[model samples]
Target: MSPPKLVFYVTVVVFAGVVIFTRDLLYLVRTETRYGQLDQYDHAVRNKHHMDQANLKILRAKAGLVHDENNIELNLTLRFQVNGGENEVRQKLKYVDKTVKTSKKEAASQGEITFETPSLLTLFTTWSGKGDVNARTHNFTLRNWARLKPEVNPVLFIDDGYDATVAQRLGWKTHRIPKSSINGLPVLKDMFKVIKDTYKSTFYGYANSDILFTSNLVETLVHVYYDSFYSDNTTLVTGMRTNIVNLTEEEFSTQTTLLNAVSTRGQLYMTSAEDYFIYAAEYSWSDMPEFVVGLIAYDNWLVLNSRYREDHVIDASRTVTAAHHTVREPDYQSHFRENAQYNKVLFRKMMQFHVEPPYEKGFTNCIDKYTEFVDKKIEIRSRKLEDPCLF
Candidate 1:
């Protein structure tokens, strides 16, 4: 190539890069602290200047959002993830998605993001009610969930371990449950049927249990997700995630299938490992939620969403926390031993919850975060329903 031609092309490319860099740099100046916290993240974080510039660019991609400051009230919906069979899991996912879009769109000038409550829609099983060995944990979880969102209708899938009294306490209706293997995971899709059969309301949400929210979390997300300004539909819900690397077919069975699919936004992002296993729960010989969530997406039962958030403790020793909530202290890690296999994946994923964060950061802190996250969701969901009066 001639020297003159080569020089001209080089100048054009460098100039373009500079223009892009300058715009993002200005953006970082606007939200530096927010982006700085995430700077360590490979996907979410970058230099404050870089992210500001990127967010600015992304905003510009939208037609009417270039410089709009209009405030809009978008509807907020809350739902839960149901682990069951292929058909059932798919059904619930569709229901939740439909609910979010249809119910929440009316109030948005831009739009609103629905904040999902994690256990709002758990699969009611009798492992706890059935008095089975595994029921011990299920019983605690079921009872707790029942207390959290009594308004959400329950379709009891397996009635083996739980009784009428327990069911009534949790405000669950008796469901004709499909027989399940003690060792198998439940289907996530079936929850859809229960919702359709019960609530005339189609809109709801899906969130995790262990999260707490900031005062502005639900409010902010609602505004942002629905904001006509934002073009991306799939929100990276989890700020932190514990990724899974080597998985037994069982562990990643359900998750791998779904996260591997294409979304409206294109590309199936594994929101986090939790959802993956959640898909494989059905037909699962082992009782694990991971497979249930993973498989549902893999089966194309649902779109692989980009957004996700972490609420629960993924690990016990790291001082780094999972959410922005208050916590009590836990010195338990000193006496507790971590599963070697678990730690390897956790460090790899760069997120460890439930487990203690770095030195001196322990259980109490997690408890605080949980308290805040849950309260935040309840507040947001309640306000959306116009019944903060209930609390």
Candidate 2:
């Protein structure tokens, strides 16, 4: 309680704060400084610096590899649609049957041909809203993803009321699931099962249809495949997405051109969240709750649960550019309001219990930042670090 003692304590506290802040500042400087030419978008450039910094920290966390710390190991395997009219469903079924046969023949020709599935499969659930932009974005996305990686098969699952003719033309396996709904969200648990049973790939990825991807997405997946630290099947992959509006189909004629466009114009927003999810096909999800896509907290809960279950969940923002091409937000209808309510209730439980996923240690905010939970509570600085050093 003496004056001298008080002064000494304050000095020590200030010095410690200065040390932490200065160290963090140096880290940002090293990672955010761009070596290449800047772009026309100033905000985008600044945002990209923050993004690149966060991504660098994430990549550096797992022994200098991109990974999240989770103890479980499921084996990384492969095997691998949605809505539309009943006719679209029928077309999808026919396509699936034909593709399965063709895949068998291809495997047989390669000699042993023991496994009946491919290495990877990607699924996109979307409804082409009443606009050319959405449809055009879908066209570019499907086309780009179809040829994104030759080894990985991509399928388009369309919701009812939307047409899949364009997708069919792109040679993507287009399927329409039954229009059953829970909370106005198409039942995805069963839908996921159907795709898994049919394609039987080693890995399965679910991405929004409006999200444009380059070849780097597949190459990043390949990087995950080769990662020795979290190479096991129990790994779940997701990443921060850059939002780029009004990108035309012609801009994406090739991966090189598309990536260049994204680099120059893509607005670097939405850090530490996910737009795409790629995971081992064998991971169990029979109990996944009903979640309408594009609604708030649906994706957040997935990250929380994955962390709770000790699965290796990674943010591959640095390695993959999962670009969101549309500018318009979804209409807020009564049903959407209901979904938001469900999200609120669910998130409350997630926050109350303070579910700590592996490797995260004390952090609980799964929305953004690789934050550290100190004193069993989230501090202001916890939110400040774009990529807080886990050490």
Candidate 3:
């Protein structure tokens, strides 16, 4: 039990201790390797899930199932992919195109869409009965108006018991004028009241039955409607007529023939002769006098009243070419007619009752502004008032 026995026992104990420590180290290494592999697999699965979500979004956008905001972003991304030579993205865009066409067709078939446009302006007139020189002239006028765009609605207010065969044939709306008149002539204010009540239009116009307008009439109104100057105010648009003597029905058969005749034979009338009046829907005719149409003083009085109200009184002479067809020279002495005198008397009465003393003269010069074509575009220019009566 001396030195030799003690050494052998110590060596055995040391070797056993070394073996146990080595086995424990190997176990620790194996556990760490398994955990690392599991972490790598989880990361790969998470990346695959993120990629699937992105692909679904793109597919939804291509199918037009995404909201507009998302579609916008998707469109930009797809466009980029298209530009980057991605043939698959290009095919997706084509599919989206086909889907859009199908969707539109489905909506249309279901009555979910409409393409009908509403009329923007209503042009109206009153004329004498058939079987007269006036009737022939009115026929030409109505036909000329029928050639205008559908946006301009043409209506003929037939005098009570008068035939509207010509207007009806031209597809114009026909209605009987109220029996209210002075000396068998329809009152201007009453006619306007009827027009306002019966029709829905952005603008209303009353042209003399003999007046022929070019397509510029509609173009001028469109410009005025969008003009910022008239945005906050009611407007009264009037212009001088171009008189063409003995303008035959043959001469007015087509717009081109009519314009050629006008360019050669037409003479611009004096500023005092305003044959047509166009006013905005917001214009008030409540205080207008019961002056009969086709009479003197009434048109003048209207211009004066519009100016008095601080409305936008625009002289459209430069833009609108209103052709007045005259079979014979107008009788200057017609101012002495009974209806003319009646209008004058009515004007005096309206001035006495409604207007202040030192009444302003009612004329084209009283207009606050005038329209003209600048570089082929309509422009509103302030008119310089040289007449003291206008101020």
Candidate 3 has its poorest 10 consecutive residues by lDDT at: 90-99
Q: Tell me the spans in candidate 3 whose CA falls farther than 4 Å from its real position.
A: 1-117, 352-360
In candidate 2 the C-alpha lDDT for residue 189 amounts to 59
lDDT of each: 0.28, 0.51, 0.64
Candidate 1 worst ten-residue window by lDDT: 261-270
Query: Which segments of candidate 2 are over 4 A away from where they belong?
Result: 1-116, 128-133, 178-183, 328-339, 347-391
State how far residue 61 of model 2 sits from its true place (Å): 18
In the range 1-391, model 2's lDDT, one tens digit per residue, is: 9999999999999999898778667644543442111222434433543556666354233211222222111122222211221111110100011111223235323321222344444555655343545556666677777764334567766656667776677667766754445444554556576677777665777777678765445444544543443434577777666666677666677655666566656655433235777777777776566665645555656676776666766666555667777755323232365545664355555552332212122122232322121222111121332333232
lDDT (0-100) at residue 92 of candidate 1?
A: 16
Return the top candidate by lDDT.
3
lDDT of 1 by residue, 211-294 (tens): 211112232333323433223322222222222222223322232221221001111111222221111111211211222311
TM-score of 3: 0.66
Residue 180 displacement (Å), model 3: 2.8
Candidate 2 least-lDDT 10 residues: 87-96
TM, every model: 0.31, 0.59, 0.66
